[model samples]
Target: MSPSASFSDVVRDRRAVRSFLDKAVPDDVLRAVLDEAQLAPSNSNTQPWIVHIARGTARDRLSEALLRADDEERYSLDFPYDGSAYEGAYARRRQDQAKALLDALGVSRDDEAGRRLAARRNLEFFGAPQVALLCVPGFAGARITADAGMYAQTFLLSLAARGLGGVAQTTIGFYADTVREALGLPDDHKLLFSMSFGYPDKRWTAQTPRTYRASLEESVHFHE
Candidate 1:
């Protein structure tokens, strides 16, 4: 976000930028964003988030390994994620989000191959020049991991405020072993997700549709 952009502007400007340019983000900008995100509130200030930003050669190598692992179905998720758990309106929103994205890319619901190819791009980091691996201790448990979500959002917002963008992907978490090996992180440091970030590819950003959020009326409950 620019100097004139308000907090609201920054919030509204943020989106899951699927495609990014080949250009790498400068080191100073990366540091500045991390600094801002560090201020995010955490449970008891435990700050369980351990972020590893991979750039240049490391980023390239990790992306390659992820693609290979994905092909072999060498899944190694630290946590079980069942999207089927979302029911009613939640499920519909998830479906709508997928449809909107595919529609924007002109991939039909019946185009199984196309959909698969699109999904595979996640492993490629959508051509991003850098990716951040968000992790926590293997035994952090559900509550501590939940605090990491706050950290993740702050990181994402910081990116948007700087005219950068990223997509937080649980898909990358599926290849936890590959990521751990690439970073030489211990098995105890569990992978939660990743955000492939950099300057968004303007061609895709300008045309790709963004997902809608729920209205407060339906999403929140009034106590008063």
Candidate 2:
């Protein structure tokens, strides 16, 4: 398919898959996806993305370590934007998302146990067979992060094109120090995000929701 059509189809079909089947993705296919992801443009062509793909024993070990860390204590997230500064529509949207998710999981607003259970699923990688960690230079500025975002979107779309699904997890970044120590990541590299990847479990009806997008006119403007 042409790049435009392929991109459009991939974007339309892509979803944040929470459950995955036991099947393993082929190495060549994964390599192709990475190749496509690297095609993403970067400032000054710095192309600053280092991806670590874990599978089998490595994947299991990392998952175990992450779950243990999460059990011990919640990690502190580094937010680019201050949540305390958010007001009005953005805050309402955030609250609505939380409510919708909790409702979908049949968890009441007061159900601490239910919330913990849902949070725990992230540590388990939602039962995905493979996980990819994206890292960047610790000293890299916001422009590098913007480049990383493009790479991530490209990676996710590539996965979707192959009938695989995944979630971009910034939560992993919250425990970057622990994760780096456990995984033996380079001192210069900082964990930006981790992604869980695998075929979706077809049995879950909860995964069927279609996400909506804002209209072009609402999201875009022209000065002329």
Candidate 3:
């Protein structure tokens, strides 16, 4: 960790790490990062996020389950995505991000097989040593999901602060049933997303792509 690291520096250094080294983070470091994430603000102090970390055999089992579910086309999501919602500017942004990622991976836009293989890497956690699944008890409403998003950001930032990296993957949430079954989670623990985290693999050239973000003028508004 650099002693001169500022908050902006940490945030700037963080990215959606697509590959990771096969290394188990020290227990103490993981615990400390989680402790920091626990301080993330929540509405009414509910702090409704439930996190499940998979490592060793557990991680392997979950990965296998997700892969099988994907192969079988068995998707049982707790919250289904509405593809139609991403229209116009939103759709364009999504497409641009996809193209950037595919280019970084050296996969042609028309290469269906290559794209499928790249998508499958999400299930494999990009060779990460550990995967953390975040959830909420009972049916997840928009408010709880928003709170969970906050928790997720704090968790990622915490990892960044410790010189670690993670990717928040909603793709895993599509196989919520498989994940819950593999992790032995109750039905009420609705899976939100998964974070595959560890030391970033510098050898993975695909991690070089930095996603584009809209300017503040395009995304934010002020009222006084």
Candidate 4:
């Protein structure tokens, strides 16, 4: 495929998959995806992404560790979500997302039990056969985080091109210290995020919700 066509197709087809099949991804395919991911640009060519791909026993161990961490209140990392700062369009968008998700899962607004059950699925890596943890060196700044985002986008797009599906999850970062300890990562490294990857389970019609994006006119400006 031509670069433009390939890029557009991947962007259009990619979804945040929550259900995965038992099928395992080949090592060669995973390596190629990582290779493409590493092509992402970075500040001063620092290229500061550290990726760890876990499968089989390692994947099970990581998931077990994450579940244990989730059970402990001390493991929670608080993120600031300023509702006041998210007024009008942004706030409505967020509400719509929640409603859509709940509707898809047959969860009522007051169904706290159902919500918790759904949240637990995140800890299970949504039954994906492969899980990739992304990290950066201890001394890296915000620029490195941006580079990591670019790398992750590349990886997700590459997976989409290969008919694989996954979700990039920052929830893994909440238990970063725990994950670092569990995975035997160096103390200086920070867990940036995790992604669950594998062939998506095609039977789940509830996964069909389409996320939206702002129009170019709303998101861009023409200086010329």
> How many angstroms is residue 81 displaced in model 4 relative to the true structure, after the best TM-score fit?
7.0
**Cα lDDT tens digits for candidate 1, 18-43:** 99989988888888888988998888
Residues 1-224, candidate 4: write the lDDT tens digits: 21233778889978888899998888888887888888998999999999988889888888898888877754633232245688777888878877887888889989999987888788889999889989888777788888989999988988888888889987777888777777788877778889999898877634668778778997689996
Candidate-wise lDDT, in order:
0.89, 0.79, 0.91, 0.82
Against the hidden reference, what TM-scores do the models get? 0.96, 0.89, 0.96, 0.90
TM-score for model 4?
0.90
TM-score of 1: 0.96
The alpha-carbon lDDT assigned to residue 219 of candidate 1 equals: 78
For residue 106, model 4's alpha carbon misses the true position, in angstroms, by 1.1
lDDT by residue for model 3 (1-224), tens: 32246899998888889899989998988998898899999989899999999999999999999999999999988987876789888999999999999988889999999999999999999999999999998866999899999999999998988888999999999999999899899999999889999999876734577888889998999999
Order of all candidates by lDDT, from best down to worst? 3, 1, 4, 2
100-176 in candidate 2: lDDT tens per residue? 66776788989999998987888778889888888888787789888999999988888888878889887777777
Badly placed stretches (over 4 Å) of model 1 are 1-4
Query: Which residue ranges in model 3 land beyond 4 Å of their true spot?
Result: 1-4, 205-207
What local lDDT score does residue 35 receive in model 1, on the 0 to 100 scale? Answer: 90
